[model samples]
Target: MSNATPPGWYPDASAPGTDRWWDGTAWTAHTRPAAQAPQAFGPPEPFTAASGDATTAARSGTRIAALAVAGLMVVGAAVTGAVLLGRDDDPARPEAGPSGSAPPSTTATATPSPDGSPAGNDPEVLVDQLNGITLPIPDGWEKPDRTVEPVPTMRTVDPYECPGSSSDFCYHATVTSRTASATDITSAEQLARQDITAAADRAYEKNIVGNRIHGGITSHDQLDSAPVSVAGRAGYQVRWRVNTAKGPGGYVQSLVFPSTVGSESLIIVRYAFDAGPDGPPLSLMDTLTKGIRPIGDSATSGGVGSSIAP
Candidate 1:
């Protein structure tokens, strides 16, 4: 061999068997190839069964328990429905349910006659009777003038002056008579004013005209500026415009007291027509004023009290 060492040979640098051989450029001879551990094997011990069967049993039990609960709920609902139906069908109960307990049967009561007087058999006859009193019903108007006989002691007549005309449609002239006390007699003038004001309030549905009370008489007029008079009473003559099912017009009401008895009398004349171009007819007002008379003669005639009648 020549003096140069071989290119691939190298001395081992480890003790004995542990010595590593080198292949010149690196120590490749010292490295061992990696090996994987072998897996243990046998007749797979008893092939342990999956817990799937026990899990299925538990799941099936849960489903059955849920179904049982649902069934019990359905049964409870049916029981409640049956109980309700049974109660509804029970014969002991009246057709009305328990909440609608039957009221005690009561005998029908007859309506008592008004003012302890019998009702009129004939409305026309009643109207005629009413017309015979104080106020005269205008002719050519409806016959058997409307009568509201609420009480035997009270009668109200609605006499229209002219039913066809809207402008002058006057309601029935009314005459009311009733026994009253001395107090009623004492306050006749006040009552008259009150009645007039009430009527005007109803007619206009507005403020009462300014007025003055003089000589036991309270007089009301329009704005205290207009010139009007009633029954020579030296005041504005007030007219009330009234609208009704029959039509619309004006009403002139007067209150008078009986000369003999301490009682009250009322007269209402309804003038139906458009307010005349010259205003209400002086003739109508004159007639109405002149017509008011107390039941008895005047005090000058040796009567106990003075009559308001003309």
Candidate 2:
């Protein structure tokens, strides 16, 4: 018998609850126990259902499903490992989904750092004394002008460095903090998202980035937004995209958390980048976010902090 189903896992001809490997040319002896969802785990578990549906919006809402642990499984296929899990739908990545799509990862897994402020002297990191927010900047990233005053902005941190045209080709990271009243925002997530939208509005109105396909100028296509915790505090995050001079190059993500000074103040850690299919993606920004830490907090201990969604 001949099989022309392309090289992939197919229902085993002889076994009812199993899948056999088809090596493009012929069926191989390799067989594994099968279920409705073909995951990279051995012995099907109850959670594979949710992880298999990770592409859908509903799956992202229910991020804590036990099977999601296996979502990052680096198994059998490189394409599967690279595409399906970790962070999917990044506009900056070559594998990003259609326009106005958000990354599949709604929540960031917080990796804890040492207690009471990171070693501030390290040049790789940028610390905001006013807001008490610290960012682990990548190498070669030029610092924001010392004279930018009040609103601190870091330019040319993007993988695409444009010599004087930062306002157009490259992305800028800005730290904005504001006084929050009880009625100002209901949740940390709301505040963060508002700040993100505000940033996008400024960019679009100023021609920093172009308008999104379905959304008007100063408006954006929100891919995903959720409440998350970073540095042991309540936080909110949003991911969105807009049009840019370079095709579809607007992918923006912002993490908003409380300032160390008091609950009344909120800090917005905004990441702006080119989400186009070309150039580098948000991987560098992800690395920066994972390394974010607070400069002063006695409650923070030396051990790594676990990331949790509040």
Highest TM-score scorer: 2
Decoy 1 TM-score against native: 0.29
Candidate 1 local lDDT, residue 164: 37
What does the lDDT come to for candidate 2?
A: 0.44
* Best prediction by lDDT: 2
Off by over 4 Å in 1: 1-133, 141-185, 202-252, 259-282, 293-310
Indicate the TM-score of model 2.
0.45
TM-score of each prediction: 0.29, 0.45
lDDT of 2 by residue, 1-310 (tens): 2111222344543466555443333443444445364322111111222344312322222111122222433665433222234533432121211111111111122111121122223344455544445555554454443422234344454434332244333344333323343445656777776777666654433433442321334336887688777766787888777654433446677777776532226666666664445433566655655656665444432212233110
Whole-model Cα lDDT of every candidate shown, in order: 0.27, 0.44
lDDT of 2 at 299: 44
lDDT of 1 by residue, 217-273 (tens): 123333212223332223223344443332333344434332221111322322222
